[model samples]
Target: MRQWRLAAALIAMPALALAAPCELKIGAMGPMSGSGAQWGLSMQSAAELAAAEANKAGGIKINGETCKVSVVSYDSKYTADGAAAGANVLAGQDIHIIIGPVGSIENAAVKPVAARNQQLAWNAAYANNALEPRFPLMFQVSPPPAVWADLLIKRAMKTFPMKTVVIVVPNDQTGTDVAGVDAAAYKHNGVTATTEFFQRGTTNFAPIITRVLATHPDAVDTASSAPGDAGVIVKQLRLAGFTGPIGRVGGPGTAEILRVSGGLDVLRDFYWYEAVPTDDPKVRAIDDEYRALLGKDPMGGTTFWSYLPGARLTLKAVQAAGTDDAEKVAAVLRTMPVEDPNIGKGYWTGKKQFGIAQGLFFPFGIGIIKDGKNLGVERQEAQPE
Candidate 1:
């Protein structure tokens, strides 16, 4: 009888290993509506793709059980209060990792709430104070303007010479801070910069365009303004007969700008910064990987590719930590080498300005359109100068 019982117990051990899998929840966040929708959706798409990839590969392993990766998303409505609300909502769901809250306002509001909830969040905020040593759990997702604005401005100057520039941005912390950095870059290159601000929700920009034209700037830069707003500004500026090169030193929205500004003909002589080298074969293949995992076409533009590596790295940290605890995951993230299968190797930089070496620095791209001709994006290696 004892030998029979031992034989039954040994046979049942295999069944225990094959039990139901657990769930590993990760949160995706950003503004999912209104003008800033494109940026937020990109973060969400990247998060979904990463989770799908992890699930396809047998999910995340915690303890001895295989856990299926799940993504929860929130739309912060492009406001500080929205992000704070989203953080609390995700925390209520027991989510310990969050992927975004794209703008400066959103990031600032969400950081404290996330820290209080013991959550690790990667933000796409380009604000001056986006990263701080005090919030060890908060990380900057992409290289900010201070990191590459000089290179972008120098390259744009090569294509379109200018002694003075007017940057149009929304009246907000992100707008003001980004414009300040971009203005410094222009000043360093011997070009005087003046910033023009508009209310966040004004549809028609004729008045502001008139004000911007009064300065007679050689070029106009839509620095950190939403794509819809930038397009309107570009359209109105062209209508106002200011036929100067339009440059965007803030975020990646060339496609949206073109669409809103009536395509390349209207946006002729345009130069801007793209978050990623969208033309590279290896980089373009990121979409193919997305299709393989998500079974859908990619959404948004450069941000989808740009945000992917951060989401991948976050999950990698979760796996390395062997648990979803924010502190443990953050510890693993700080120690792990910055690299992504899609975006390739990156750097753990941001100490000079932010006082924390937690920002992810990746190679960026410069895009140009000259006289109605599309001149594809050129890759710029990440030089942490």
Candidate 2:
């Protein structure tokens, strides 16, 4: 019996040695095919970059062992249903945490699924005060759209003597949310906001533009999605003879906005609220690397300044947590605040950005398209008024 016990112990020792000392997997979901595909794809690359950098540095130390990281990516095609489906699939796997479902509507739809699985979701586009009451496992890094809306209104009020604003939003739920925030912000700022809704695929904005133009508002505040939608709206507005500065709140297509706008010099001085800036050194390095690797500037895809910092923050939290357990990592994430150069120079207090005050949060950067082809970023610190 003693001999048998010794042999069994020896056999079990090797198995234990081969077991991963520690391991963690971060799941990323985005629209790789649909309208929002560019944001999703870009985020995946950024997460991969962070993961690779972490692993190359000898992985993260967790508990008493070094934890290896694995990245799992899925495409949500920019739809709420798609996001929920992708979240379900990823949650079914042995993932330690999740990164995104790019848009706010998608985030809202899938956050409950993450809660059901007792996992963490660091969604990219959610910044609403309302989210706190819903999903506890879910956190948003971007400033609430209402804040951006207020900033834009303040900008317009200062830059131009504008008295009225016309708001255009996507007819979808996400767009509706964007409009709601914009209205709230305008009211808070002592300005009146008139809103209009449009379907996602609608190309002809003649009627809507005409109606808004009739309102003869001092400026047009657009809350549609990406460059494609915003570009279409701007072009149609211009064609309909509206010359006021057009603004977008949540999803603005900084990369392809010019191209999609038909090079009509419409966006020459166009202003949109940006989450980060492209000029940060770390962001610049990543952009340069991407340009070298892709043989062209990564247009319409993930750009360093736009959507990837959140991924880096997630990885950093995992590294900081030093464990693969979802709950443990989630707890660490709730309190992790990042000041990465790539994100901007401002500060994002985790308490203000995340409901639990223990998740990852970073500063928001405002960007503008200047001289036809560059994103000029500005840093501002303002709480929701």
Candidate 3:
């Protein structure tokens, strides 16, 4: 009887190991297609790199055992319904932590579903209520306009003066949240600002460009439009003989913007926001590391670099917590220091704004293009929100 019991117990041990494989799955979601594809792809790329780093180091230590880290990516399409479906999909797979949905509406949709599913998500959205106290698991990917927009506007005006500006964006939550803040920043700097909106997926921006030019503003700002849409607007603006300075106070997509806007000649006298210190050698090394590990060049744009710290820190937290459970991970994440090897020192802010000190604040960057000259990017400390 004793020999038979020992054999049955030995068989059950294998079944238990099969039930929980020696692997950790990290979930990544974003708009992986369309004009906004760059932003979502950046998130996916960042997560993939973080996982690769962990796996290369023999994976993260969970419960005293090294488990391989693998990334599962999803295209949330930057929509509420899309994000909801994505959250359900990841949750169904027993994924308790996620990194993505880089738009205001998508984050709004994701938070509720993540909460219901007892999952934790980090969103790169700049919406007003991106990180609420109620959703302790929801964390901001980076600081919003209120933290860096004022300085960016000041620098831009110093480089290229503007008395009036017209900001164009999509007629969606992402547009609304960014346009309002960008306009406020412009106004605070004593520049009169007006806003215009176009439905998402409007390929031809001639009508809006005409409306923008009719105002005869000193500059037209592509506040937070997708890089693709912003590029078309810049192209049309140049074609319309609008030679004044152009501004981009939204997301990082200067590479894509330049491609769409017909390069430096057309995008002359441009001032925009960047999220990483591209000029720093340490920061630039990330590109080399990414290419070396992934065997391909990084998805272009500073968003990918900016998104890295969050993903890296999350993995570190998983190692420290020794578990993938959302609540435990959140607790470990809160106590962990905000630091990245390439990006350097940062802090966890958002206590005043979101009632939780969960937002990631790192040094930001501002880029300039003057008279077809690429002046590189300048780094600035991200103030506490």
Specify the highest-lDDT model's number: 1
Which segments of model 1 are wrong by more than 4 Å?
1-20
Query: Better model by lDDT, 1 or 2?
Result: 1
The TM-score obtained by model 1 is 0.94
Q: Return model 3's CA RMSD, one decimal.
A: 2.4
lDDT of 1 by residue, 1-385 (tens): 9999999999999999887669998888998887788888888988999899888878887776779998898999899999999999999999989999799999999989999999999898899899998899998888789988999999999999999999999899989999999999999999999988988878988889889999999999998998778888999999999999999999997877888889999999999888878888898898888888888887767788898888988888888888989999899999988887766677888899898988888888999999999999998877553
TM-score: which is higher, 1 or 3? 3
Per-model C-alpha lDDT, please? 0.89, 0.66, 0.88
The order of the candidates by TM-score, greatest first, is 3, 1, 2
lDDT of 2 by residue, 100-218 (tens): 76777777777777778776776666435425645666765555564466776676455445667788877877777778778777777776888988887677888888899888887
- At residue 71, give the lDDT of candidate 3: 80
